[model samples]
Target: MAKDNDPRLLRGAAVRQRILDEAAQYIASQSSIGKLVSISIGEVAEVAVYVRNQARVAHQLKLPFDQEFWGSDVTQEECKARLQEMNDDPSILGVILQRPVPDHINLRSLQSAIHPLKDVEGMNPASIGNIIYNDVALAPCTAAAAVELIRETGLNMEGLEVVMVGHSEIVGKPVAMMLMAEGATVTVCHHMTRSVAMHSRRADVVVVAVGKAHLLGPDMIKPGAVVIDIGINQTPDGILGDVDTEAVKEVAGWITPVPGGVGPVTVAILMRNATIAHQRQIASGWLT
Candidate 1:
C-alpha cells in the first residue's frame, strides 16, 4: 500500500541494479573463468521459475551459469556425490541446490556437501554459522534482501526494536540473527507464540515470513512502523503477502508490497552472493 514514489522502493530498485551491474563487471574482469551452477533433483515448476530468473540475471551480467537436472529417482548419495564433485571443482565458483528435492534425499546432507565458499544461496550450515560472528557477506539471499530493504528506510539499526514473525531456517531465523547483529533488539515468534500482535505492536519494524496470507493486519502494526512482508502466498485471488497491505500501509510509515517488494531485491542479492563467492575464491588463491 506504499505510494509508488516510496524511497524504499526506489532505493531497492537502484541498489539491486547497481549490485547486478557491479557483479557483471567483476565477472567480465575475471574473463568469465568460473560458472554458477544450480542442481535440481527433479523437475519442479517453482524451481524452474527460480532457475530461469537466475539464468536471465546471469545473462545480463555476462556471468557463466548452468543448470543440472537429475531424475526424480536420484538417490541421496548420488546428490551428495555430485555436490562434492562441484565443491572440489575450482572452475565452479558458486553452487546452488534447488529446493523440493525428492522425499528420500537428505537435503541438508547435500547442502553440507557444497563448499562453504561456493554456497551462493547461503543454505550451507557453515555459511549460516558464520553469521553468528557477524560474517554477513554469505548470508541467505532473502534474509539479506530483507535487511537491505530495512536499511533503505534510513533508520538507525542500533537499538531498533524488531519483531520477526517466523522461525524458519531459510528466512525468519537468519533474518533475526542478522538484525540482532546490527544491534536491533529482536524478538522471534513462531507458531507457538501466544500473542503475535503483542510482540509486533511494540516493534519499530515488523518482518513477517510465515507464508500465511493476510496474517498480519493494521491492528498488529505500530503507527509509522516499517513493515516488511516477506511472504508470497498464491491465493485464489492472486499472490498475497502475510500482511494486509492496504490496511497496514495506512497505519505504518512504510511497507513493502507483496510482488514488487522483496522478490526483485532477493534475486539481485543472489547475484551479489555469487560475486562474493567468486571473490572469496580469488582471495584464497583458488582462482588466479
Candidate 2:
C-alpha cells in the first residue's frame, strides 16, 4: 500500500495554526470579543472528545471556550430557550450545539433557535440554505473539509466527475451541492443505489461518508482517482474509515486516512467558521 502524505493535509494544519495565531493577535488587539460556547446534553463519550479537542484549539488561539452540559432530561424547549439567550448575548461570538443530543431534544428545532450569526457549527437551516446561492463561507465543517481535500488534488473542478456515497443532509447532500457550485458533475449514492461501485468507478473523484467500515475497496475506485474518506467507525482493530485504506492506496492517486485526514481539517474548518461568524457579527453591528 502506497500511503501518500497529502501536502494538502500539511497545508491545512499550517492554515489552521495561522488562523489561530491571527485570531489570538486579533483578540489581544480587541478589548472584549472572541468567546465560543458549546452546549451538550447528556454524557456522550464522542461529544466529550470533540469538546476537549475544541477547547484545546481555543486555548491555543487565545479564545475563550466554554461548555455547558445539560442533563438528558432537558427538554427541547429548554435547549431552545438557552440558545436564544446565548444569541442575545453580545459577549458570545460563536455557539456550537454538540450532536447526539438526548432523544427528547428536537435537534432541528434547537439548531434553528441558534441565531444564524452565532451558529458556528453551521447546522442551522439558514446556514445550509446560504449554500444554495453559492455562499459557502459558512458551510458545514465536515462537508467543507471534504471539498477542500478534493481541491488539494489540483484538478480542475469544472466537469470533474465526482461520486459521493451517502445522502445525509449534513455531509452528503451539502457536499454534493457545494461540488456542483464548483462546477463539478456530482452523482450522490445512498442505500438505494443499485450499484455504488458502478457509479464510483466511473468518477474522477469519490467521497465516502457512509458509517460502514471499509465499504469502498480498491475495485470500486477508478485507477488514479482521488478519494476522500469521511467515515469514522470504531472497530476491533481500532478506528476505521469507509474506504479500505490499505487496498485503495495502491490503486487511487490520492486518499485521506481516517484519523489523520479529514478529522484535523474538519476542526480547522470549525475554527475558520468561528472566525467567519465573528466577522458576520461585526458586519451586523452586533459587535464593535
Candidate 3:
C-alpha cells in the first residue's frame, strides 16, 4: 500500500460527486409531488456521517440539496414507527438502518417494512434479486464498494481463483455471487472451514470479512496475491482487520489498509445508491 494519498482516490471521489450532482438534477426536475421525505439516521454514527457527507457532496457538485434526517431510537415500537414513517413518505428517497441493533429490536420487521424502492442499501429482497440476476439495480452498498475496490486493482478477475473468508448474507455470500458472475472461480469459507489457509494461500485474490482480528498471517498468503480485509475490529490499540496487514503487505503486491481502504469507499458507494434511489423515486412520480 502506498503511504501517500493515491491519485486514483481523487479521481473516484470526482466521479462519484458528479453522479450525485446529476442525480439531484434529475430528482429536482420531477414534479413537485415527488418531494423527498424522512431520512432515518440510525444509531450507527458512521452511517449518519456518510449520509451527511453525501448531502454535502451533492451540494459541492452544484445540485439542489434538501433532506430531513430523522434518528430513531432502539426499541421495537420505535423501529416499527420509523418504518411506518419511511413507508408513508413518498419523498424519502432512501433509508439507512444502522447495523447491530439490540437484541430486543427485530431486524426482519424493519426490513420488511421498508419499501423496495427506498431500500437504497439493497438489503431488500428485490435488490438481492437484482444482484443475483446481474440487473442494473441498487445493491448492498458495502458489497458493491468491495467489488469496485477489486476492479480498481486492475487485476483480471475472469477465471481467477477468489476466496471469500466470510459467509454472512451481507458481504461474503453476495460478494462471492458477484465474483462468480464476473466469471471468476469463487470459494467461501467461514469458522467451519477446515484449514482456511489452504484455501487462502491458493487464491489469486483473498477477501477476509470475518470479524476476527488479524487471523490470517503472512505465511497463510501466497506471494504477489491481492488481499482485501473487510473486518473492522476495535481493540485497545485501535481498529484491526482480518488479514495481518503488516505481514501480508510485504508478501502481497496489493493490499487495502483497514481504515482508509474499504471503509471510505463503502460510504461513497452508499451515496451512489441513494442517488439512484432518488432518481427512481422521481421517475415513478407516485408521491407527487
Candidate 4:
C-alpha cells in the first residue's frame, strides 16, 4: 500500500476531472428540446444524471450520485426508437443505452438502432467490430477504464499473464480483447469457472467482475500483481465488489476499491465518450 498522494492517483484524478469538466460544458450548452427523445425515460434519466454529475465533478473535483435505475419497465425498442429519433436530429450529439435490459427484448436490434457516432455505450455490433478490428470507434467505458488503470500503474503489459473473471460483453470480454491486443496473454472465467482462485493466483493481473461478494480473498491474488475489481454487488454491507478489499490490499501491490475505484473511472470514461461524441458532431457540421 502507498500514500494517498501517489502520483499515479493524482494523474488519474486529474484526467477524470478534466474529462468531467469538458463533458459538463457540453451537457449544459446542449441540453434542449431537440436533444430530448422518448426512450426508457427513466433509464435515460438515470444515465443522463450520471453523465451530468461526472461533468459537475470535473468542475468541483467531487460530486456524489445516489440514483438507481432498478425496476424500470423500459423496453429495448423504446430505447432504440428514442436514440434513432434523437440521432436523426442534427442538434443531438450523443446517446447512451443503459444496460442489463430485461430478457423480453432483442438486445441486438436495440444496439444496432443506435447511430455509430452516437453509440456512447459502445455495445453495438459495429462498435464491437471496431474493437475487434482495432478501428478506433467507441470502446466500452469500463473496458477503457480498466486499461487506463493498468497503464497508470506504469507496468508493462507485454506478455504479462492476465486473467479476467467474468464473461459479460460490456466489461469482461471486451477487456480480455483489449489485454490481448496489448500483448498480454488473456484468459476469461465466469460463474462456471472451476478453480478460479488457482487461475487468479498464477496471473500477473487479476480482474474480478463476477458480481459476487468477496469471491476473491487475499490468498487468491499473486504478489506484486495489479488487481482491478469490476464487480458492483449490493449486499448487506451496501455495495461490494467481488474481491475482498481488506484481504487483497495487504497481499497485492495495487488494487482498486469498489465504490471509489472502478465505478468512478467508468463514469469518467463515459463522460469522455460523450465529449468526443459532441466534438465529432460539431466537426461534422451536425451541431451548426
Best by TM-score: 1
Which candidate model has the greater lDDT, 1 or 2? 1
Residue ranges of candidate 2 with Cα displaced over 4 Å: 1-31
Q: Relative to the unseen true structure, what is the C-alpha lDDT of residue 3 in candidate 1, on a scale of 0 to 100?
A: 69
> Who wins the lDDT comparison?
1
* Model 3: per-residue Cα lDDT over 52-88, one tens digit each: 7656654554433455443445577766686777666
The better candidate by lDDT, 1 or 4, is: 1
Clashes of 4: 0
Model 4 RMSD vs true structure: 5.0
| Candidate 4 worst ten-residue window by lDDT | 32-41
Find the 10 residues in a row with the least total lDDT in model 3: 6-15
Report the lDDT tens digits of candidate 1 across residue range 129-195.
9888889888899999999989888899999999999999989989999999999999999999999
The residue-level lDDT of candidate 2 at 181 comes to 99
lDDT of each: 0.88, 0.85, 0.71, 0.70
Question: By descending TM-score, how would the candidates be arranged?
Answer: 1, 2, 3, 4
Put down candidate 2 lDDT per residue, 1-288, tens digits, no spaces: 323454323234544565566656766776667689988899999999999999998887777898899999888777877888899988888898899987778889998888889888888999999998899878999999888878877899999999999999999999999999999999999999999999999999999999999999999999989999999999998999899988888788888887777778788778878888888898989888
**Global lDDT of model 1:** 0.88
When sorted by lDDT, best at the front, the candidate numbers are 1, 2, 3, 4
Instruction: Please list all clashing residue pairs in model 2, or write none if there are none.
Output: none
Given candidate 3, what's the lDDT at residue 43? Answer: 58
